[model samples]
Target chain A: MNSLSLSIIGFGNVGRGVAEVLYTKMPHFKKKYGINIKVVSITDTSATIWDQEAINLREAIETKNHFGSLKFWGNEYEVYKLDPMEVVKEIDADVIIDVTNDKNASKWHLEALKRGKGVVTSNKPPVVFDYKELVDLANSKNLPYLFEATVMAGTPIINLLKEEILADSVKRISGVFNGTTTFILTSIETGMTFKEALKQAQTAGIAERDPSNDLKGIDAAYKATILHHLAFYPIDFKEVHIEGIENLSEEEIREAKKEGTPFRLVATVEEGKVEIKPKKVYENGPLAVSGTSNVAVIETDLLGELMLKGSGAGIKETASGVVGDIIRAAVSIYKYL
Target chain B: MNSLSLSIIGFGNVGRGVAEVLYTKMPHFKKKYGINIKVVSITDTSATIWDQEAINLREAIETKNHFGSLKFWGNEYEVYKLDPMEVVKEIDADVIIDVTNDKNASKWHLEALKRGKGVVTSNKPPVVFDYKELVDLANSKNLPYLFEATVMAGTPIINLLKEEILADSVKRISGVFNGTTTFILTSIETGMTFKEALKQAQTAGIAERDPSNDLKGIDAAYKATILHHLAFYPIDFKEVHIEGIENLSEEEIREAKKEGTPFRLVATVEEGKVEIKPKKVYENGPLAVSGTSNVAVIETDLLGELMLKGSGAGIKETASGVVGDIIRAAVSIYKYL
Candidate 1:
């Protein structure tokens, strides 16, 4: 069987979840595609670990979970305090899975693409910063650079466009793209103040310690930037107008609900523009998703309106997209390369 | 540049839509995939038209629209009363595009697969009756047999499961799978009897003249059978327990709406069983679609729940799925073969 090698950047929740999935689903993939996969390297913030004979994925997950870093990998394994880019230059793999939220992650993503490695990522900043450049490089290299988890993690919206909707032109895309904002806004609708809902979301690990990006609609704008680039044209993430949910009062939400519309932090891409702001959606509309669930309603030329709904948060859900992208890349590599 | 030839079986409304999409989107595919596709032949029930130089799609569409069938081909083209199976045996093409509702369409499908041609179709009976056998043959020959339009037209649900959910196990699928039933039931909710709503649907061309299959839930059962085979296991279409909306009155539908649940003809696949029946859905549920829309909610192990919604009818929409599948299979053939 042909063996596929993967190097993972970021051994955090989503990264660990990818490992867990690859561990469990390896057999299924091998049986299906006549290919086996190996994790050759894993890079965390502090250090990088490498095992050319294939890293022990379960042990790697356990080590990271117990000690918060890849530096704590077992003594027998070769773990070094190497920079992530250094690991990218040294380790050899067919694909690099970026699940980090680091600003500099795009550096390694570009470097890997330049080196002819397929890039599969759940990281948004890398895509938001370098979508066109990376896609160009990947096309030049004849490699697959898929970021299915970048927007609406694991929901396959990106794949939906790339694989299925190519025959039709997408005219507009409106979505509840941020989970943190959704949690806060929906909580406020149930009588919780914005601060109280923020605290609750932070307590539930749904929001970061500093949820400024989500609160300011920058996160949704980032996702919208990537999707807009894929669906229509490339625009700098800064070009998207941003309006956060930080100012949404419970009274305003209740008022909107009284009027039979609910306020959602919606990101809309239409007519070559990206807009992120709180918008009133009909109660029965496809964008009326509750809880932390994310939804996208894509209006197309021929198919009219098509809707996709699923969680855009959580480790496993994100990993599902990342791993699915990896398999997609692997399948292409197996077929063409 | 590569050239892909397609032989279309059954030049009905869907067939003409495929021709229209291909005619309009040829430049897009040629630019993107570096492949130009041509329809080598188009067959109706009465006759088949053959042209290796590519059938004039616009003329074919106009001719079929003006004339009752394809038998009235222009004097410039080669037309004869050739059986569809005979056309399948003689056509030199990379793929067979089946858009017929013919019960024995699977015969041509098997013949095409046996002849090493990839199969892409909007036809359901072929899949419902011969799913496992056809899939096994396609897998053994390394060909793609895709039927995305068989379920929700061009909604891409099948491609979602195949390309995105391979790493996870699907636990269940629940969908409002029939457009006729949805149109009739939702009409009844607006204060119409079953017969009245069905008559309105028939008048609107949403229901066939003999709407027994749709009124008996057999159409939804056929779709559930196909999805169940893809998600879990293979079962005969007859095995699905079907309950149509024919017995429901306007009072029952209005009472359910008053109680906050709306009646929907839902096809549910869970625990290796396919059930098609009218059931109560929460007003805000994903399956609670209005008009002739179709919605499917698929639950997987890692991704929690994912939903897809779109029009399950219309010539353009169904043609979108069929052409997308044809492109998919053509890409495979272009890449590996």
Candidate 2:
């Protein structure tokens, strides 16, 4: 069994986390599933590293820790400071994991699919931008283009809705699809100002440096668009109505609470239409119960209603999702190749 | 793009319901996923029916409704009252669905694997009896021997544990795996005696005619054995200390409620051992929240704890599981074959 070689396109928090999980759990994963996974190449805007016969992950980790790039990790491996597209073609990889923040990485992903190489991504921008084209490319090539870590970090909502719970008809899909906005909204519900809540979310490592996307519901809207597309129901990103937590006032939050309801930034798709907005929901509603913890409630005809709730974002959780996609892709490889 | 040819081994309630779902959903499944699923043969202890083209599902339904046996449908192709093993070899089926009540069908399933045919079953007997052998045979043959309907009807517990929630070392698997006991116990909690509860459960289609297995906790024990095996843990049925909902006094039930807990017959596996017995759980606990509905809570090292709750047993729900497995098997066929 040849090891499934992986080339990571980014070296950010999640990309490094995937490397760490693969390194730490490689022995266990091999022992259990007969999967010999190797992160053979890595590329970032700053630098690139490539080793055909498995790079020394320990050295890479240490180099990243010390000099912040693998370019100065000595002549043990082929190194470059080229663009990601150049690295994608040069690296002898079976799969290209697009973790770059570039919104146009989705195009690269499609190109990879066209080149007959599988694409697994954690980047949300690509999926939120051109999910249909990506899906079509994957389907055309009979290759898997999985983004398990995109929407809800570790939660298997995509697989759950797509494969397992094949609902005859999906009536509604509603949830807290954004962790940053959820955290900020939760803080605001607990009497914090919008700026104070955003700061708290940032301090908690839940929000980005520029918290505009988190505050304006754009992140959640993107997630909802991707989810709706995967559900086989295409809804335009612009058509997905957005209402952010930035406008919620202390008085409004208090008033909603007083009326036996809670203010939650909810993203929903019902009857093919998408709605990504903050709405006051009563205690009986599923979104009301989902506070800081992210929850996805899928209402279907056959399965009736199913709710999946858990930590939506983190290194461990996001890495778990990526690793899961890796395993699923491995299973497909085992079956197909 | 060959149509999925199916052979149902038991023409019971679940079998008929599965037929209904297939008959209704085949067009949609074919149009969406390009899977033309057709039940080619059906067998019961009383009679058997086979048609190479496709069985007249409407006529079979009418026969089952009128004569309570599929015999009255008249043989358009081939029909017989043969053993399940004979059907396994004789029928030109891509998949054999064993919904038989026999606890020893595991052997038949293994034989099917030997013949290079896929098996989807709702019967828990084979899995509970010898899981390792069945799993190994299926793996060796590169065939799917799925029993998603075995543990929790339509809850997707097995798939949820296996594929969706990729747990890093599942710490414990516990749930109300038996619906009859749950229903009886719930009735007892609602001011009914054990005998009255059992009677009501039978009337409500929750309990079987021979309810000894459920009342004595053996049914739940079987499910626990299967679950433990699926989790890749070595747990023998004999090692699972069984204690059912039998012989519980009304005072015990009342006392349980008084302490803000409820008496639930739980099948639990921890540290590689199995324990099936009734336990008192707090109101916030999964078991407490799961009333007559079946619930399974899986605690893993990475994913923390996850709970899946839904209707435990019913013709429709159990049939939903069978159909879900069918769809999955179809997808697998598309990928692998």
Candidate 1 residue B226 C-alpha distance from true site, Å:
0.8
Give fnat of each prediction, in order: 0.72, 0.22
Per-candidate TM-scores read 0.96, 0.92
* Model 2 C-alpha lDDT per residue in residues B133-156, reported as the tens digit of each score: 888889888788889888877778
Best by DockQ: 1
Candidate 2 on A1-337: residue-level lDDT in tens?
A: 7688888888877777778877787887887777778888887667888877887777777777788876777765667776788766666777888877787886678778877778888888878778788888888888888988887777777777777865255678888877777666667777888789878877877788998887788888888888888775766777778888777788897778778787888898776678878788866655764434677887766666667766677776777788888877776776666
Model 2 regions lying over 4 Å from their true place: A66-79, A282-285, A289-292, A334-337, B74-79, B165-167, B334-337
TM-score of chain B of each: 0.97, 0.95
Candidate 2 to native Cα RMSD, angstroms: 2.7
Candidate 1 lDDT for residue B284 = 79
Question: Which digits, one per residue and each the tens of the lDDT, describe model 1 over residues A87-150?
Answer: 7788889998888888878889889888888889888888888888889999898899988988
DockQ of each: 0.72, 0.42
